[model samples]
Target: IMLVSVTERTREIGIRLAIGALEREVLLQFLIEAMVLSSFGGLVGIALATAASLALAHAMQLPYLFNLQINLVAFFFSAALGVIFGYFPARRAARLNPIEALRHE
Candidate 1:
């Protein structure tokens, strides 16, 4: 379901590519957007996770021994996800035939 909407967004990308933007440029643009969105969502997720962890610890009567630190591993995972998800859309958009795309209604 989510991917369907993503494909719709890709249409706009196709338009951009058809207008003379290079493939690598389109990929970079999508990568940057994905990184920005992922960072914002990751922050929200980390905050919620921290709150939930604290609440669960309190409820179960555990001490503050566990830590919720944003380590290198988390950064790597988020970056990987962003790149992985953004690549296909960027590639699809970059490959659009300019003539067909321009003709699209």
Candidate 2:
């Protein structure tokens, strides 16, 4: 996903670099995009899991417990995974030569 993003936005990155955007800034932009995407997915997953668990517990006449710690851990883990996975592509985007990227067809 990150690679696709970087590849798709090569021209944008080149324009940004051409316009004097710093490498770290470009890197940060991609990193933030990845984290947001992962975090949103994680939140949706947690919501679905919670709803399903609640439905099952009610059907079984059992207590439904929402484990905050587990949810937090999962969310953070997903965000961390995004950062780890995104770093490579972000680094690559940041390192792109403005002329070469702009000339990409």
Error of 2 at 58 (Å): 1.2
User: For model 1, how does the per-residue alpha-carbon lDDT over 26-104 read when each residue is reduced to its tens digit?
Assistant: 7777767777666666767766777888898899999745443554456567767877787776666667676666665
lDDT of 2 by residue, 1-105 (tens): 999999999999999999999999999999999999999989999999999999999999999999999999999988998999999999999999999999987
Which residue pairs clash within candidate 1?
none
Q: All candidates: CA RMSD in angstroms?
A: 2.9, 0.7
What is the clash count of model 1? 0
Where model 2 places Cα greater than 4 Å from the true spot, the runs are none
Best by lDDT: 2
Mark the regions of model 1 whose C-alpha exceeds 4 Å error after superposition. 1-6, 66-72
Q: What is the lDDT of residue 68 in candidate 1?
A: 39
C-alpha lDDT of all candidate models, in order:
0.67, 0.96
